[model samples]
Target: MTNIQVLDNPTMHNLLINLSKEESFTFREIIEHTLESFSVNGERQYQPPPSIVNRPNGQNTLFRPFTSDTCIGTKITVESGPDGQGRKSPPHGVIVLTDSKGNPTGLLSSNEITGYRTSMNAFRFLGERMWIIL
Candidate 1:
């Protein structure tokens, strides 16, 4: 077993803000680096199996395991339909990050990371294409 830091959304956001200022950095560099992994020559140490997507009780769940040169992690999430009256939304799953030694390093909120990655990817893709149209 490896030591792991489990941080909630607020803690994670606060830490990231401080780190951004301290390093004088934004996520642009990180996102750009990640985008590089999508190119023609990017390497995958191991291929990913087909993801699992099932909807029992009319709810959605997706479980995916992926690897790269820097890390390996899994994201498991569930969506219990849309927002409604007087109902608390279900707590989604987590993104579990493990190191090269195969020991768990961190467990982060799935929603937070997923939202950020999705939004960034959309913007980067659109931004690149929009420049061409102008």
Candidate 2:
């Protein structure tokens, strides 16, 4: 049984911060893990490109879907103003992780996950390239 956990922004931020400080995984490990997750036996991973729609209030919303061997999810992000001239809010989305039976075994919020993952990737890139010298 999958237990649903609803985490607000503050809680999510705190959790991510804690994980970042831990630095348990090395940079190379992160890169390897990400690449491995993209494929399973031998199939290319696929994800839907983001689509944007303009709202009546001059705002724009983006929708995207991604899938891997273990997870499937859709993300919707709201941006204020037609030209992105107004305040933009973080993405509010859901991620569903499935089991071998194709049943959802876990649900997670995407906003903080995106933020945390992006930061981790950046760190990984730096760590991977930092050793290169001119």
Tell me each candidate's TM-score: 0.67, 0.62
Candidate 2 on 104-129: residue-level lDDT in tens? Answer: 56566667777777777777778778
Provide the overall lDDT of each model, using Cα atoms, as 2-decimal numbers: 0.68, 0.63
lDDT of model 1 at residue 52? 54
RMSD of candidate 1 to true structure, Å: 4.1
Error of 1 at 2 (Å): 5.3
- Model 2, residue 95: displacement in angstroms? 4.5
Cα RMSD for candidates in order: 4.1, 4.3
10-122: candidate 1 lDDT, tens digit per residue: 77667554655424235755866764663333444364754656564556777777677667788787767655564547748788888876788889876666666667677
Measured with C-alpha atoms, the lDDT of residue 95 in candidate 1 is 84
Pairs that collide in candidate 2 are none
